[model samples]
Target chain A: MINLQPYENPMYFGYLLIGLLPIIIGMLYEKRFRWYETLFSFCFLVLIFDGPKLGQGIALIGYTIFEVLLTWGYVRYRTRPKGANKTSIFVLAVILSIAPLVVVKFTPLFDPQHPSIFGFLGISYLTFKVVGMIMETRDGMIKEFNILKFLQFLLFFPTISSGPIDRYRRFIKDYDRVPTKEKYLELLEKGVHYVMIGFLYKFILGYFFGTLLLPNIEKIALINGHSNVLGLSWSLVGVMYAYSMYLFFDFAGYSLFAVGISYIMGIQTPINFNKPFASWNIKEFWNRWHMTLSFWFRDYIYMRFVFFMIKHKVLKSRIAIANLGYVVLFLIMGIWHGETWYYIVYGLFHATVMILTDAWLRFKKKHPDLLPSNRFTKVMSVVLTFHVVCFSFLIFSGFLDKLWFGFR
Target chain B: MDNVRETVLEILSDLTGSDEIKANPDINLFETGLLDSMGTVQLLLELQAQLDVDAPVSEFDRTEWATPNKVVAKVESMQ
Candidate 1:
């Protein structure tokens, strides 16, 4: 009857560390305790989906079966001797992989109070994994289908709720081998460091920014902006910065916990953030912020879009094609976040900025003297990019919708 | 095979807009900022168009195709 959300509290880490000890010990002895690791993952998964969340647990089971079968089927088709790779079939498989997530995302629009039957925590992340697998299979990159390994990857407890989204091949390599003692010792050191940093970011700074400060700031902003013209006030700027900090600390902290725990288990799950605020441009920000997700969007969505455009000769100009790809990528990203106007706007805003940044870079290349590369310019770029990103975050935060139209 | 290498190096240079790819065939294109996700796409498209080497975008792994020499080898192997 015990239900636990991932990294929900200090107690979760206590349980996690205790559960990881056996695997850690086994790794130290140059053994991968796969059975025990599987057992630990199941137990933790149960804790996450038990009690009042039993429906979601059931949903997750059904969803896992569905994805596993879909991936297996696709791989089998692709790898079959004399199999003809049909575009329609590949497209259908990808669509099927995303169907549940689409339904889950759209459910709220139809019924505000009721959760979708297909919905589960981390469904989006799971969908990303399945879609990635399907795409790889299509590309002839994923030629083998191992159902058990697929299950393990999909159900990896540490990153189940959210992810630094591990790739199939990258994950399997780590899963199949026990790291050398020295390497594991290093992993242990870094893992411990990351978890400690996560604690500071999530429990301390995240708490201070999100829990302690956000509500008060929001209240003040609402009060001051409610009567102001177009509900605009300086207090809203306070809301923007506070929300941005909270978003970064809270999510980055959660990501660190995921990555650290994966490290402890001998899986080198990718890091999600890399000093994102230091980015000099919107394009660079995507590279640093929630890196795995952005990279996913980049590789699977953006790159593919550009390739499709070029292959089909949809646009004559490469620049125009690149610009259109950004629009398509960000628009899809926005819709994936949810069916909201602000989210769409946030997507378009990023798309426009990315295009402009590309144009500026090209122009700067053409006229290097106009914008000299100095420390001052570098600082200015970062400062400007940070505020631009913060403004996007404000739009993402949905405070504006509330400020303007009183919808939270 | 030499033609494949030369062609791939030319494509890399064109896509990156830098002759450094040819100058240092072993340089990490990704790490050195010479090639990126978009650049990778362009490279694949150019390769497909020029050499008739049908390398899918998804098959373009960074680790496997990190350098001009490796890319040339990959193209040759595919051929």
Candidate 2:
């Protein structure tokens, strides 16, 4: 039995390119082999989850079927003029869609000895897609739910593992149309370029930062930084920068591969990262980093909460409502990462910084003449924001937890 | 309608920190990054406070209120 994780190694790309050639050729001559594309997607899914990972394969299939039924049911109900379209029903559907992922997330935290039966590697990403489907249906954004299309979107092999989460309508637009000859050629060009960038980022630089430098830096930090007992040392700082680079390169590399492959398939899936390190503020950093997920959080969680707060007159101050929304959104996100103190702290740290940034912006608004915005100040702002973000990454690395808790 | 447009643009420009936003009446506020859902909340409040018109969030569809002009018309209709 042969199994391949998507973009796990260079050898995997060799197989991927071979498989993709037929699709590319078909696409060039104004033909899209839809059936073959589905088959191709399935074969890759099998290679990733079959064999020793059969358990996860079963879990993914069960999860997919469950999502199909739930979302399709909601869609059918929504289109009915007299059918029940209550908010409670929508909320119930949303909860059911995400219930599996919630169980998967909580399993290890409570019972370290055993994981959930419904757990799989990309369950979280799948849940995001399904939840989006349900929410959009309730909002009347999605007028129809084509089962086959939903399945294809849910199991889109390129982005199944981790996502730059694509919207159903946006994805359908690209999927349902074959690009013109000129446009296909452009996509081909960009696809190859994105893949090459992936190679540089994942194969070369990711290897250097994550596999090579990260462990060494971590060891030095643990040995020296731990001795301080107060958890402040240059070695600890070294771990922060190294881990941040490793995290950025590794994830960005994977996203490029996913997005590049989607482009080759003529689906213009969104790009995930946009030079996040250069952001001069936390809000801007979020827009440029793991963008799809953050934007998903922003649209679904943060904004929705603010609307709810204002609708009910729950909070009197607009600024207070915004800050409150940030706290709840990040807290939920923190819990989603894992049930760990470090993860929670990482979330809280960002929320606090964002609140500060908001307050500072408000202050700067009142004192426009007092605050300067020269090229030097712009450079300084970027530098300062980068370090503050790095400090948050340090909390996220869980190294401090290991240094403090694991040692003692 | 002109007064309504000026008020909407003023609130939007102040919220987004961009004076240039007021110039484009037909710009898709959400897509152009001039306005977001949070900005929508503020826009609704300002419309109510300044113009004595209620633009409820539930009624605020992106397509219906896609621009400053559309917003002005929507608010003016409530009068």
Best by DockQ: 1
Residue B14, model 1, lDDT: 79
Model 2: lDDT to the true structure: 0.85
Write the residue-wise lDDT of candidate 2 on A292-394 in tens digits: 8997888678877887788789989988899988899889888889999999998899999989987887788678898688999989999999999998998
Looking at model 1, residue B63 earns an lDDT score of: 85
lDDT tens digits by residue: candidate 1, A1-408: 778889987778888889988988998999988789989999999999999999999999999999988998999999889976999999999999999999999999999899899899999999998899898889898999988899999899889898879899889999998899999999999998899899899988999999999889899898898686777788889999999999999999999999999999889999999999998878779889999999899889988888888889889898998989989999999998989999999999999999998888778767859977799999999999999999999999998888788853
True contacts kept of each: 0.91, 0.17
Where does model 1 exceed 4 Å of error?
Answer: B23-34, B63-70, B73-79
Q: For each candidate, what is chain B's TM-score?
A: 0.94, 0.85
Model 1 whole-model lDDT (C-alpha atoms): 0.90
